[model samples]
Target: PPPPPPPPPPPPPPPPICQDVGYKVYRLVPKPSVQDKGGDTLELELPSPRSSILDTLTNMLCATCKPLDTPIECLIEDALYKADGEIYVLGRISEDDLIPFRSHKINLDGWADLHLQDFLNLGFHDKNKKDNLIVVY
Candidate 1:
């Protein structure tokens, strides 16, 4: 009988390339202070309150219906100077609702202050010193 032909060589593997062709970046300038409603509310004390607030905003953005087909990359831009007792709630707020009230003390009060080390740990670099800003890409 004729000798069996040698088995064919295996096919070459695909090239080392990223699956994501491109990315759509979205920046969120979160409020420095988030309302502390008290009673078992998870309080995240961060060096940059804006970063924490960004998380809440990101979650809300994710929950909403897809506005675009392309994948989104949410970026957080941290800014200093806390807005005294500024509580950020999840949900849509009308323009009229944004009016400032005379009352200083509200149900949601308190600020999560983050420091240099904390920002570094969270993969944010100091974008500006004078303005006190940190950014995460």
Candidate 2:
């Protein structure tokens, strides 16, 4: 019998390097704490606090080895309903807020919002576990 023909060579791998440019939405979940409303009747803190998440994300991006755009947005507790412990932090916002944060274009929407409780449910582990700013990114 004759030998079979050789198979075709495999395709070359993709480019060695490429710029990393993209947008990411993160949900900031706070760490656990003993402080709670004296009773169920008491009001609970909003899911993802706007100010807190904004601060944390700003710091994280700044500290990142590969720094990205600036002037990011913070959409905390946008949802109308209550979602257990998982908050949803959306990168998309309304057109109004989008203008000012043009520097950080990553923030898709001008009106973005997030829920703190919902964020925690995403399983964001923190060392201190004290109202952690959970970033879903």
Candidate 3:
């Protein structure tokens, strides 16, 4: 019997879309606390209160990694409803009152009114290895 024919050559790799530009991305994370337990409230200390915006997204996997498709304004207990913790939602005015560090977002979907817990719920835990917001506690 005769031998079989050889297989075709492999295809070339896809062209590059663009160069990998290094962007200074920032993710809002709850200030690392050695201990947090004073009722059902979680306090996040942001470096700069006025410079950053906080908003909530629906089914978003990561807060810092991507832009929100639809962001809803936070009423009094928006974070409480969206959060997966025992945090008692307070009027954002209170949270904003005591932040001790600067936090920033990419400003997609009107980043003007994002909430603290909302940002955290989106997966800014830094455990997510995306190039977006990488926060390590």
Top TM-score hit: 1
lDDT, candidate 3, at 76: 41
Model 3, position 75, has a per-residue lDDT of 36
User: What is the Cα-based lDDT of residue 89 in candidate 3?
Assistant: 28
Better model by lDDT, 1 or 2?
2
- Every model's Cα RMSD, please? 18.3, 15.5, 15.0
lDDT (0 to 1) per candidate: 0.35, 0.39, 0.36
Error of 1 at 63 (Å): 26
Please give each candidate's TM-score: 0.22, 0.21, 0.20
lDDT of 1 at 52: 62
Q: What is the lDDT for 134 in model 1?
A: 18
**Residue 22 lDDT in candidate 2:** 73
After the best TM-score superposition of candidate 3, give how far the Cα of residue 123 lies from its true spot, in angstroms: 19
**What value does the lDDT take at residue 87 in candidate 2?**
25
Residue 80 Cα positional deviation in candidate 3, in Å, after optimal superposition: 6.3
lDDT of predicted model 1: 0.35
Which residue pairs show collisions in model 1?
35-87, 46-114, 47-114, 47-115, 48-114
After superposing all C-alphas onto the true structure, candidate 3 shows an RMSD in angstroms of 15.0
Q: Per-residue alpha-carbon lDDT of model 1 for 100-129, expressed as tens digits?
A: 421221111123322334333432333443
Summarize candidate 2's per-residue lDDT along 36-86 as a digit string, tens digits.
Answer: 566755554434334544454443443333244444332434321112222
> Among all windows of ten consecutive residues in candidate 1, which has the lowest summed lDDT?
101-110
Q: How far off is residue 18 in model 3, in Å? A: 12
Q: What's the C-alpha lDDT at position 120 in model 2? A: 38
